[model samples]
Target: MVFKRMLQALGVGGPSVDAVLTSPDCRPGGTLEGAVQILGGDHPVDVEYLAIGLLTRVEVESGDSEYHTDQEFHRQRLTGSFRLEPGARHDVPFTFPVPWQTPITEVYGQHLHGMTMGLSTELEVARAVDKSDLDPVAVHPLPAQERILDALLRLGFRFGRADVERGRVYGVEQELPFYQEIEFYPPPPFARGINQLELTFLPTPRRLQVVLELDKRGGLFTEGHDAFGSFDVDYATVDQVDWVAKLDGWLRQAAQRRGLLF
Candidate 1:
């Protein structure tokens, strides 16, 4: 019994946790259903509570530098308290709401390079080491988002990599502190003046706030600088809009002519 307690303290023989998702794939603003399966340790243990949260790797900027860290934004409490009897197994069901502005990790069934997310199960154990596990999760894009992305692809822009940048997009009603940047290489037509295109989305219940950052390429006599633009689209009318022409017009008329202000 003493040995068992020692092992439990080290979490070697303590309650083990495994997070199981009903489906690994979900769209932004959707729900992910899952269960936290817990198996008793070698001895009985008191569990304070069970919680599940969504976490992702984000890059945070510091003074003249940036660093990456895991960020957890959404969590759901499973239970107030529970007892794990020796040699027993329990499953705690959960339904976690994916944030409306959750970053897209996959597009059309392909993983976005450099994007990742996890569903982490954390068990609060009393007088014992905490037990937890992290499960991979894939968040897809919404229709409006997909339409814009497809429009970019149609424009000959190639997908680069994506990452979550720390700090909010100024002037945007950003609920979450971080924003996702989907990078793309400018096609041949604009490659002379455009270095890259970075896209971000902040979706509310009624509309999707899209931010575009244009990285300009410097020529012999000019210096390179970044430009930004913010726009909104009604979720109800996303499908009705012709994304190709609309996005093209936005890039040409607004970004090139007037320039996107930071």
Candidate 2:
């Protein structure tokens, strides 16, 4: 409510808004249900509409420079025009679908070090400044996502960091303006072959599109370069896939040398 006081301070009386989420934890391709509780201030006021948005921090680059900023990825309308009478209280319920590409904010019940996601509510009051509210929201990994993460840990690839960068991965089908990258240091067996590994997941309702980036190390009579690979995995059958074996194959393929324009 500290942020809401700005609107309240401008006038003697104005309607106030508070967003309450009934179900705050969700996965990509799922819906978040919530209610906006509106309270009347000193007089009657007309409200134009109410909406909820999913927001996160993202990095943007411009002319060789990059910076981070808060961005809203998706929005859902809750209510149309309405009137708030003196001391009247109203509840507006909403069910908004989380985007299929929604970034994962938590894994195995632990918050990702640098990732954050939230639900922001906007209330436009006629003839008065609009009021706003925000609540912390968590997007958990889907079944396939969970299994991959668990497998990576089991493979001894320690988590390094994660971030959302502004731009699309070349050759990747994505609806969002950006994508999330999860970085890890290579395990003992692959450490000498690779400097590090970056993993990105482009998930749809039916399956997952995984991209792997390998930073290969330079060796005698050779130069180091990045190698890329992409593949699809079914959500229903992902559990059946031998990820450890599959990932090992990917490591070998990505480490193999390829002819270049050089």
Candidate 3:
């Protein structure tokens, strides 16, 4: 979705700007190519610069409460010191590299609920800058990511929800300000001992950091709490590992390690 608005800084008769993204669906570290179209108004305008900003919605925890906020992570200048004549049509094309640590917005072609991402355009006409147009964008997981998710689904774990948190995970190297946590309901055999499961993936050029948090169920003599486990896996193992069995084993071990199951 794209929204367009006249450059308010340029006054009522100023030029209008529209940003169109060629590829709305992209993966992390991929190149996003798009063109910013500028339509001149009744007179010539001195456009100082044209820029694009990448925006996403993030959750922040404040003391005893949590709230959602809009964040702009990336920005670039597409054009500088350009002149537009009356009724002139100009297109400035741009290709920007997405950050490698950008959060995943979709999985298995399904959009994650409660996530909103967009590409916003900024036009500066003689210091009358307008940042009103925003284009929605979608991000998907990589090949290795798909393998892990497939493994979980094959193990009978159902998708509970997915969200982005504004803090870093313990003992993990992160580049972005936020990370994605995908939660799932436990399957049978382990369901009796575990309340919920949360997965966090931090990917690098060569390997992926997998963090698993299990909410253990309590018994008459035990108290309920969370059990955290982290490991690193190479991309080559995506096809080599028997993910279904491996994931099942991981869950069983995690439950036992936390004393959830005897």
Q: Which structure among the candidates has the greatest TM-score?
A: 1
Q: Mark the regions of model 1 whose C-alpha exceeds 4 Å error after superposition.
A: 1-5, 258-262
C-alpha displacement of 206 in model 3, angstroms? 1.6
Estimate, for each residue in 187-255, the C-alpha lDDT of model 1 and write its tens digit.
877676688999998988889999998888876877888888889988888889888898888887655
| TM-score: the better of candidates 2 and 3 | 2
Scored by lDDT, the top model is: 1
lDDT of each: 0.87, 0.85, 0.82
- For candidate 3, write residues 197-219 as lDDT tens digits: 88888988878888899988888
- Report the C-alpha displacement of residue 37, candidate 2, in angstroms: 0.7
Regions more than 4 Å wrong, model 2? 1-12, 217-224, 258-262
Q: Count the backbone clashes (under 3 Å) in each candidate.
A: 0, 0, 0
Candidate 2 per-residue lDDT over residues 52-119, each given as its tens digit: 89999998999999999999999988888988788999898888899999989888898887897889
TM-score of each: 0.94, 0.89, 0.89
Of models 1 and 2, which has the larger TM-score? Answer: 1
TM-score of 2: 0.89
Clashing pairs in 2: none
